[model samples]
Target: MRKEGIAKRGEKNKTTIRKILNYISKYKGMVLASVILAAISVVFTLYIPILIGQAVDQIVGPGQVNASALFVILKKILVVSLITAGVQWMKNHINNRVTYYVVEDIRTKAFNHIQVLPISYLDSHPSGDIVSRIITDTDQFSEGLLMGFTQLFTGVTTIIGTLLFMLSINPVITLVVVAVTPLSFFVARFIAGKTFTMFKCQSETRGAITALTDEMLGNLKVVKAFSHEQEAQKEFEEINERLAGYSMKATFFSSIVNPATRFVNSIVYAAVGVIGALFAVKGFITVGQLTSFLNYANQYTKPFNEISGVVTELQNSIASASRVFELIEQPALKEETGDSCVLGDAQGYVDMQHVAFSYEADKKLIEDLNLHAEPGQRIAIVGPTGCGKSTLINLLMRFYEVNSGTIKIDSMDTRKITRESLRAGFGMVLQETWLKSSTVRENIAYGKPDATEEEIIRAAKEAHCDSFIRRMPEGYDTVLGEDGGMLSQGQKQLLCIARVMLCLPPMLILDEATSSIDTRTEQKIQNAFAKMMEGRTSFIVAHRLSTIKEADVILVMKDGNIIEQGTHQELLAQNGFYTQLYNAQFAR
Candidate 1:
């Protein structure tokens, strides 16, 4: 059964290779021209030895050693050599351009696909792994294809051309060379199969190391605060050691192919020399013919060695290519098609009916859920950490599809609307802030890319972040490092809130958006949010119960189900989950 599974997987890898070839097929004209040029170059190269033999015969067959005739043949060889060089250069140039273009197309496709992938997919896959597919794996594929084009066609043509030439000189010697050549193929095949498995393992281990590094470096602050550097290093070293082991094993197996083929080719060459001398002695062939035949024999077997080595390198490329193909071929989020409705002016009246969802098939998370929010209502969701509070928000944003239910925004089913338009109707501020390395002004204006300087300042002021901005050396023009590392956490949240304020969408979701701020700053931002939420439907998920005291409606939840819900005063009077949560914070 395991062997059957391995066979199926090998078939899949071949299918992936064909798909990669299809990407190359987009540049069919250029690829064909290169192949033709490669053939011409090989012919010129193979004809050189024949010219040398003829020149030798011309000089030796008669008394005076025909200097004029030999010179003419030497001139022809020089011309062919120049032409061969030019054609080879041209072929290489075209092949490289075609390879890079195909790589660029694949990278673009992968990035675009990533943009539309469901949030669940991103949640499950590591950012580093996805990045490896886009950059490292595709790059490896590019190198392989580039070298494959430069060698495979010309090498094969030289082998065939040389064989034909050798047959004309002495058939017996040609047969001997042919018989030993298959030994190289069998050896290459046997070794390549093992190298393929090792290379695949190496690629995965390399990605694992990248992921570990990304995770550790991204959280360096936490690691230091906990004094866990040694632990982090130990974890990284484990993965690094695994990667080294796989790489060494793969290279060891691949390294054996060249010398093994060379060994066989050396034997073939020795046999050709002895056998051809006998033919020459019997007067069946000339010494000149023996010389040409020996050249052809060497030429014939050299490609086998070259191809075997190329095949070994190509195993690494193919392993990487298979990884890239797996990512490209993953099922992306279902796209809205065939005249889906585009949101125009959203009213923000949302409802969930009989909603159900699960991250995994066997363990259901939310089931038979129902919720409704009137336009302009401020609905707050409060619960324990894994009680599906954020999951509810995820469902509303259509980030994950409901297992069996309908979500309607402004009385239109969300699935019927384009996700881009649907998402545009709402502005979100989450606990985990995302800010790129750019000027403060640009980060504020992210949601509304065309916002004027004045509009940007206005939003920053409204979010209570303008005071701190003015204190910075460059104010709004200051360039921030990755994730706005130059700013404090609370200040970063304020910038995020300012970004949302610029968009002024009709609906909002603030999932602990003010969690990083102190009470005074939180109060100021909350006042601004109050005004913003007055005429817009908003959902707030907060761990700090005091923040939602004035929310128009509060839903207390536990274990993926809403246990109680009412206004703050009403829920406090009931003395249930909400009462206990609110009291616990003040109790501390």
Candidate 2:
């Protein structure tokens, strides 16, 4: 079982490497050039030590030294060294470009994939975790990938070049150096395999910490209001402690590769030294040749040390790359093709038949539901929390697809219609307001990105937010922070209402849209919405029953099933769930 798990992990690592190589291969011409430069640089670099050895051979004794020949050899060595340096610099420059390009591609794919994922998937996962995969994990992958691209080829080429050069010098001593090199491989392999799992854990925990911090900080106001600061801190500390533990373990194990490979390599160096000395003393090879052989031994073993370090980076890279690939490869929401039906000039008709949907398969939320609404009808959905009121809006918007059933808009099945065209036909305003960091004019124009300034001000006035907008220092051009910084909750909600008013699509969905405003402002916005809803099919999910009393039909729901349906007066006369709900609100 243990062996099988390891084998699976090895296979996964290979897949990660293959995917990364595919991205790198897109710039293969540059990669090939860098590799060729690396090989050329290694060749010149290897020749320098040989030239030095020849210069050493020229020094027979102090008085017998070949001064002119020595100077010529020295000059040759200088020229080769200079050539090696220039080639390596060019190789490194190309490598940097290729590495960052690959990172950019991966990050782009990850972010694009997120946009197409189903709302269910987004709801199931933390935004911070997803953001970490796109930003932080990709960043980590790039660092490891950069290190690999920068060092891997050069280290490998030097090792092979040194080995060939040593073979030419004296094959017997070369054999001795080669014999102890396996020890370095064994050490690096054992440590690297363990570190991959550790580093992967560390990466996941970093994502968890990012998620926790995002959640805690995003709701810091709520946390302070509830006085849960200590509890939040404790939770953060627990995850942070876990992250530190994972990082320490991963770093410690990866750190071991350098020294461990060096230690094993030192033994190889010692063996080469001892054997080269014997070969020198036996007159099988000259002192100068042995000097070159020793240099080759050091060169060969040095690559093993450097490569061991690179392997550690490659392990972390593969781990991070796997995470990024998982996100990019997640099953995206099924998309509409070019031939998909488009909703053109929707008539505001909606029909839901035998609808059965659930966020989780084992737990049903909405089931066997049926509804019909004519164009221009106001259908008020009234229910307590978790009664599928907002969920019905979700289904109607196709944010969450019905598990089994048909939602027809204008008698065209929603499944057949292009999602963009279908969604474009509706304007939605929810209790939870969202505003990007932009000017007030931009916020109002969000739903209709190309709205004229006059149209924007008109929508703001309709939503009763124009007065506040004019009071700001820059008025329409005043830049707001994310989620409408410094704006009161009611003001932010008003801006969201204005955003929807700007579009005023043929169909509307108002889910507690007026819950945040003062009652006087709520009444004003309701009047504006009433005028806006004159000829559009509107689904109003409301908690304050009085606001929805004029709805053409009121559907009161409980436990995902609607039990009462009629005009508000008729439902009150029924004296059932809707009556208790309506009277309870007014009673308070």
Candidate 3:
């Protein structure tokens, strides 16, 4: 399993690298500048050794020291150092700009892509992991790009220039230096390959820790109520331990890379010195030449050490990039292809023909279902838990596609219309009301951003929440806590209804909209819902029979099929499934 995971990760890394490179292609000028600066810096660096050799030969080794020549060489060396510093600074500046913007572009695309993903994708992936990909993985890519590109560009230029200089002095010694290059590369590659798995594991474990922490914080009320503080702490400690263990393994391998490279480099340096000394004594090499060769040998070994360090960084980056790209590459939910058509002055006719759907293939949630609602009609669906009531609403909203049937609005198949156009025709108040941490007025006006104070108040009054809202210190401008934690469940539901009412869509869906309210509040909400449902098509999925008694149509569902359908009066008259359910409930 671990090997398979590593292989899959490697493939993903390759794909991500391609995508990153493609993004970078847009900033070709900046990349070119960086490369040029890097090459210039390396060339200037190579001059330092030559300047030293010239100083040794002209000033320190001859019968008489040449002061003028020494001054000229010193001036040249100073100029080269200054040029090298300036080029390196430019390289860093250009690389930083390129890396930062590329990361920003990728992050924006990833975030936008997430918004268009189907609800099913979110359902399958953990929220924490998704969040980590966006935040942590993207950060890794930024760091990796900066460090990796800098070292890679500089290292290659330095190695090439140094080898050419060494060969100029003594080809034999240069050959010996070149021979060790392959061995260093092989060792670095071996270590990198072995450590890749640890890096991946560490990333996964870190994501898990993030997810667990988020989950705990989100459900802090429940945790406190159950007094599971100790248990939660223990669970967190265990996750932290696992993450630390994987991190340690990854770090351990990374730490070994530099030292190992240095050791190999030390051996190479010793061999070069010994060989140069023997050649010098045999009159085969000059002292100045030997000095130059030694300088080049040190220069050559620097790339190996730098490359070893970068390999570790690259491995971590590749792991992070793989996860990030996986999310970015996920196919977005199929979008409507045709031009968007508005439902202007819509009459809200809806029909579902032989609809079939399943979250998974083997377990069908809604099967071979048929339903219809005329313009300006109110329909209610009632069933036991897991009986496809919510699934039906999901299909109507086009959140999920029907497997073997069609849903249509005014004879237009839903798939033929853009999601924005199709959904714009409806209003929804879900059971789990979601409110952003914003002003109360903003939350109410979410459906209509341009709504005025008067219009917002009118909608709030209709939803029966205006009076209570006005009593608050800040009224409509009051800032809500996360998910509206400052408000009661019933108040939150009322606010959600007000939000929906503000939109005034031709159709409204109330899925357990009254479940969170008390009996008195439910009555007020029912009145508001009735007012909203007037002159519109509406679907109500509720367990409460009283709430749907006035509905134009009621469908009794069981096990993914509608077993009974009629008006509330007609179903009661039949005394069948609907009648039995009504009796059992009222009998309680």
State which candidate has the highest lDDT.
2
| Strongest candidate by TM-score | 2
Q: Which parts of model 3 have CA positions greater than 4 angstroms off?
A: 1-13, 58-66, 226-238, 281-289, 339-341, 467-474
Better of 2 and 3 by TM-score: 2
- Residue 557: error of model 1 in Å? 1.2
**Better candidate number, 1 or 3, judged by TM-score:** 1
List TM-scores for all candidates, in order.
0.96, 0.97, 0.93
Better of 1 and 2 by lDDT: 2
lDDT of 3 by residue, 311-414 (tens): 88888888887888889889999765656565565678898999999999987678889988898899999988889999898898889899989998998888
Worst 10 residues of 1 by lDDT: 55-64
Superposition error at 193 for model 2 (Å): 1.8
Evaluate candidate 1 by giving its C-alpha RMSD to the native, one decimal.
2.0
